[model samples]
Target: MISRSVTARLMMPLAICMLMLCALAGVMIYAQLMVSSANRAALQGQENVTELGELRSVSRALQRDALNLINEPAGEARDTIAKKFDGRMEKFADGLKKLEGLDAHSFVPQDYFDSQHKVAQQLADVAVKANGGDQAGALEDFRGKVRPAEREASKVADERIEALGAEVEKLIASAESADRFAKILLLVATIVLAGAGLTAGFLITRRGVVIPLLGLQEAMGHLAAGRTSIAIPSIDREDEVGNMAQSMARFRDQLAAAEKAKEAQAELIVSSIGAGLGELASGNLEARVDAELTGVFAKLKADFNRAMEELQGTMQSVNRATTGINGGAAEIRQASSDLAERTERQAAGLEETAAALTQVTTGVKETAEGAQSASNAISVTQDQATEGRKVLTEAVTAMDDIQKSAQEIAQIINVIDGLSFQTNLLALNAGVEAARAGEAGKGFAVVASEVRALAQRSADAASDIKKLIQGSGELVNRGVNLVGQSGEAFTRIVDQVTEVSRLVKDITDQTNRQSTTLSQVNVAVREMDATTQQNAAMVEETNAAVSTLADEASRLEQMISQFKVGTRRDAPAPVAAPATVHTPAPRRSYRTQGALAVAAAPADDDWAEF
Candidate 1:
């Protein structure tokens, strides 16, 4: 037997081992975090040291540029040098700010930053003097104050860089020491945890696995040898061994029960077999054995009972079937007779239907061909109508354009008429002015009268042209309206032709479908005629078979009469009724003329009227 509580037995020791390992891991992780912190601190210290060095370098550069700016003559060169000096001063200030903002207060002294600020201020003063073109004075200031200040600031920055470097070195050393310590501690913890795990494993294996398994093995050996009298010693334990012991005890009890049942089953088998046989010998076919026994004996009991049941059931079935067969044989004979009569009548009907289908198929084929021809003609008519509609549409559009042109001509004629009237008015005014000049203007008056008459003639011509143009515009508009009407008529003709084409096509498709369907019907009718003839032959054979079946039923009845099925022996057998034949109804015809009537009625009235 295997241990059932194996997981529980090992859980505590494994859990402790895991916890120790977790603690060791946590210590290592903490050491790693400390190392990371140290590295960050060292990195900040290095940054501060670098900043300090840059600050010192920038201070020296500022001093040099300031000195050069003072020595440069009062010109563009001096201004350029002064700008460079100012840029250097700005850089020095930024370096100081960067150093101050660095997280290295522990390494860089505050007095170093203060000294740099003082040097920046002195440089600023020297830049102001040089920018004012006072080269001599600026030189004096740079020498007297800015140079000394920058030197002092440089000295302080150098000292600060050195101090920061030493601090970084110390941080690096501390990080290395911590790393080494963490490694040593992790190694020691791992060794101790491994030793503990080994010890715990040995103890658990000895206490929970080995002893219990040995006891279980011995108990299983006893069970294997069929020694139910042996004791299972680990039954009182609270582990997998105890469970195994309990299972063995249960198995032993079941075995004892099984043995008892075996003996009982043997006696039952003998008694049941004897009783059943006696009953059978005594003419009681209903006698059966009990099949409630368990294990291997149950199969024996069941088989014996099943055999007796099958014999009894078979006898009873045979006895009953003899009567049913007598009546069923009579029914089959009657049904066969009726089927033969129906088949003969169906064959006659099918022959008639085949002839009719042949005639219908011929008619449908002719109709399909005619409809196809009509469909083609209608398609041609639809195309001509469509072309006519296009021509009428163009005529309507042309009439519209002519109407617009006529209206434009009318407008121009009106403009010409207005100009003629103006010319006539100007000529009349000239005649009045000539009359005011008396006899000296007599000849001028005649010319003005002549000019007025010509103007009047021009006005008359323009008026006549305007009236003609207006009449033409009206006529064109009327022509446009008439053209529109003609276009609409053509559109209606096109629609009618299209509708006729659609209806003709539909008729053609329906005719084709009807022809196809009629062909299929004809084929089916022919096949049905053949099948009916075969059926008639089969029906004659069935009648002979029915008579033989009836004779067999009689013999079977006589044979089943021998078995004493625990019932009265003198019971009367049922007599079969006489057979009867029923005639079937006649089949209906599905001809293509009926389909055409349905298809043509709607299409001719609705579409063909157009």
Candidate 2:
């Protein structure tokens, strides 16, 4: 059960807590929404009451204004009062419309408000009619009909306003109660859920972990204190605790066996190698254990004798090994010192190389950026040149159109000039005929003379207009040629700018490539420099290790010399050496190192021409 309940212990409590919190939140939100709705309704009711009060005031004002309009004589004073009455009428209608537009009016009956506004409209009519003529009749209707109707309507509005006020108060009270109830519910729910959650969490923790852990803790404490004789609880259960308890039991059993085995081994070792131990203590490495014992003791006896023999050989071997180690240590120490110095020199050189490359990279990157900027500027110049060419072309077209229009105007002026010349010729012919008719034709002759003078003036005016058109035509032709020449110049400029832009772009590309290669080389050099520095450090460490090894070898040899061995000239076979350990060289990842030298340059803004 405990094993299967692992997931439950972690998940169930959290699920319960979340469920409780979500449910509480839902309830609180719903309650808040309800409270908000009620509050809004109450506010709407208040607004309606305010609108009704304004309407009632406007109604009373309308009555006074209407009365004034009826009583004031036919004069400016009455006209001014009439305007006031109209304004009051408008205000009264607007107030009624505002109340009718309210959300409260949507569900409430509108008949009460309808009857009220009807009274206001009737009173307006009575005042209007009285202002026009029928003063006595207007007064009769104003008092008997309009006044009574307004009173009744006003009474109804007052009742409605009072009722709305009461309803609003009820809503306000209800909202306050709901708000308080929602707050209480939220608080109580939170407390209850919190308590329940805490209780559930405690039960899960106690059942799953605390109780079992307590038992395990006590058992472990006993085991740590070397109390392995007692039984461990939960060992038979199939759970994590059971597994732990079982492991401890196994450890206790093994510990007891080790103690017994140690005792038996101690007895056998003492009985078998006691003599050899005594000889060994006496510094005699020739002692031998000849007891043919059984089990591990048999091997122990052979081992004792062999150890003595090996000790004899080892002592003799140490004498020669110490001299060799001393010589080797001197040679190694000299070699490592030289290596360290060389490594330091090499590292310094690599560092200098890296620094130089970095500077070169920075310079090249700047050059590339400068080239790119120049290229961009040239491209912009080219674009402007192209746009200027477009404008010039449009100007040329406009100049050509103007020249055509001037030519058309010149043709029209020539037609007018011809017409005026024909008119002058006809007027002269008429005067000749009039002169032939004698005294009666004298008036006609004068009229013909006037006509001839008018014809001449018309011809002169047409001639002037023709001359101006010809001049304008010439100017338009000149303008067209100038615009065409400018267009050609702009085209040439655009071509030159485009070529310059292309050349600058080429330079930028080359500079960028160079900068990229330099940066990659810089990165590679840094990697190599780092690797060289690591090698230098390793060499220093090796020098220290060699020194330590030499000291340890000397101490071991001196210690071996204290033992008394037989005259064993031949040394036993030396032990095979363990594999040497080496630290790997530092490396860096440069994915583009090989390609950097052969590939096209990068177009990055950071790249320089250098």
Candidate 1, residues 316-435, lDDT tens digits: the string is: 544553455455456546655765676686689769877877887899899989988988888888888889888888888888888888878878888877888888898899889999
TM-score, every prediction: 0.38, 0.40
Output the number of the TM-score-best candidate.
2
Error of 2 at 189 (Å): 2.9
Model 2 scores worst on lDDT over the 10 consecutive residues at 601-610
Predictions in order: lDDT: 0.64, 0.65
lDDT by residue (1-610, candidate 2, tens digit) is 6424333453465467668767866776667777767866766666676677668778877777776676667889988988888888888887777777775465345776777767777887788688778887887887888777777776777677658756865776677667557645744564455455445544664565446645655664564454669787767756445555565566556545544566656554455455565666656667676765665455445544554554455344444434444444455456556656766765787687677677777888898899999998888888888888998998888888888888888888888888889988999999999999999899999998998899899899988988888888888888888888889778867765775686588668767866875776577667667766776776676677656655654664565566676665454444434323332223222222221211112222101110
CA error at residue 101 for candidate 2, angstroms: 2.8
Report residue 102 deviation for candidate 1 (angstroms): 2.9
Number of backbone-clashing residue pairs for each candidate, in the order shown: 0, 9
